[model samples]
Target: MSFTNKIKKKGPVDIVKPADEVFDNVYPTRISNISYESVIESQKAVKEFEDKDRDILIKNLKSAYEEVFIKIIEGCMLSDYIDTIYNNLPEKIKEDFDESKCISQLLNSVNIYLVSSKMGGDKTSDEREIPSDTVESIVLSKKELHDNIANKKFEEANKRGKLNNAVRLGCYIRDTKRYFASEGFIQAKASSIHSFEDVSEHCSIFLWVDNIYDISKKNDNPSFEALFTFVLLHELMHLMMDVFDETKFGINGAGNLKDLGQLYGYFREESLANALALYLCDATRNDALVYSILDYFVEGQTTPYQTGLLYIEKDLLKKAVTNWMKCKKGKYLTKQLAKEWLLEVTTESPRQSELTRIEDAIATLVP
Candidate 1:
């Protein structure tokens, strides 16, 4: 009946795509950090297989892949030795499909571990620069926003209002904490893990903020500023991931296995989003703010969203899994937002505007 219901019927198998397309470039964790010069030297050192050893090499490579799968089943990400084995396999030895893709998927799982909480973007980040928002631009945008809001053009006003706030905050953080580079950030708005857009010569981040009103609020630990700022920084990093690395995003078309051959796709965008948020929190030294998110990010509260619906509070994933399991072909699928029954704060009557609903959901999650 609903989109979330359709997904639950499909299951999680289609949730991930092969890393060669959706993931960051060749991040077979084993070789992710290996140097080009070293790779070159290794290439130079490749000796031709002896006639007898040819069969041995293929057997060994396939055998190693078998063992590798076993290790993966047990959750062990053995390093670049994986890359070496895959590359050494002659083209004819394997014919059905990619045996290595699963390995890459499992290896890239380490991307969760591979990113240092303190690391900024690579050199390309330094080279890309963000254009500063001038005071005139900021003032003009705000005035226009106020008029639009006064006229009840909320959607249009929201678009203009975020730029000044995002740009100003981004400039301040880059100057002090050095968490992000000087450029390649975008100011944007959205309700979910959306993708790319160009803004001020940088990619725009489409993250949802619970309360745009909280922009001017000070040091509210679990408030909108804390949540919005962190999301802002995280999305900027995602833009960079697109530029320089294979995004750890996954791909699973709607038909489930009907389209398994597709490659290079969307991030479990939220996975990278949460990861980036964790690091940005550390970089900003905002303990209380980051701790608030601990229930969701560090504790792995995201799996619930895979059902493609929304919820709130304890046992988020567990509830989602249960609901998903109950979903049936003939029944009307039920996917409820945690506060679907709650009254909108922006309204006095028992009615919810679409914006009110989105904002309320954001408040529930971010707070």
Candidate 2:
């Protein structure tokens, strides 16, 4: 039987794993052999897609989305599957896990778009450009600027020093922007609620084909399907928890209102998204694919993402997800809350050693 058939029949609890077999059946040697260079060369060759070609590509992706991800979410909502998470959650938060909200309605609301790359990495619009004329005119004869400044006749030295400062400042600004662009912002992103104001009323998820391939090449080359599904799950969670009121969080992750106007995107929110995604993978029994995907998120990623997975691994997943869904604007699982909950759990449970490690982990994050 096909994998989808297997999934529908067994639900998440009994779904099959050894992801390679299922992926091979569907994609058939299409993804495993892909390399960073190969993806780059193929994209470079295409230049731009004609209207008809773009439509066909999107059509195919939507079909695959229905066949794969839709079923994956469906299976998670099935009786034995969701019960694993729902049953463990506190009574107050149980309402969010009800059949109505857990349905595919939220899944279908997000629109997907394909792009080659997002622009921040290439250049910063605000970056200052060095003056070409000034650079060309400068001729530094002396080894040191201070030495030239000592000589009363060294007017040229002064010009060279100013030019050198401008060039250095320009380079420094350019490099800093590039680093912040790549690190602070997600390469693959889902449109925030604000996007609805200018774009269509519906939210959109952008799949940067170039960035996807590049990340895959960096990680241990998990199947493209597996990675895409994980990314979609991450983005989807963001959409679900999205709120217009930043006042709900009151303070930033750092305990200040410096970024009060912005929606909270700190450890609690990110980890909840990741922990919930990891929970789905576990409930679905997709161990083979899930472990690699987990590593993909945990390894070489920023603090919040890594810490998010750590929360899941430490067995706070069900509660963490529950709090994010039910509490005040999904901001209840703050670092302070996590520490308090961990202390409670550690005191009541026999797994003192394991809980200690989690406590140590949470200590590193801001309260």
Top candidate by TM-score: 2
TM-scores of the models, in the order given: 0.24, 0.46
lDDT at 316 for candidate 1? 37
lDDT (Cα, tens digit) per residue for candidate 2, span 114-196 = 33443223311112222221122232322332243333323433233343321110111111122111122322133223312
- Model 2 per-residue lDDT at 347: 35
Candidate 1 lDDT by residue in tens digits, 241-351: 333221211112233211111100111223333444454455445466567555432342322111112222223322322222121101112112212221121122323
Model 2, runs deviating above 4 Å = 1-64, 78-102, 118-202, 218-220, 243-247, 251-265, 313-315, 326-367
Cα RMSD of predicted structure 2: 16.8
Against the reference, the lDDT scores of all candidates come to: 0.28, 0.37
Model 1: runs farther than 4 Å from truth? 1-199, 206-221, 244-267, 295-367
Look at candidate 2 and give me any clashing residue pairs: none
Work out how many backbone clashes candidate 2 has: 0
For candidate 1, the 10 contiguous residues with the lowest summed lDDT are 258-267
Q: Which candidate leads the pack in lDDT?
A: 2
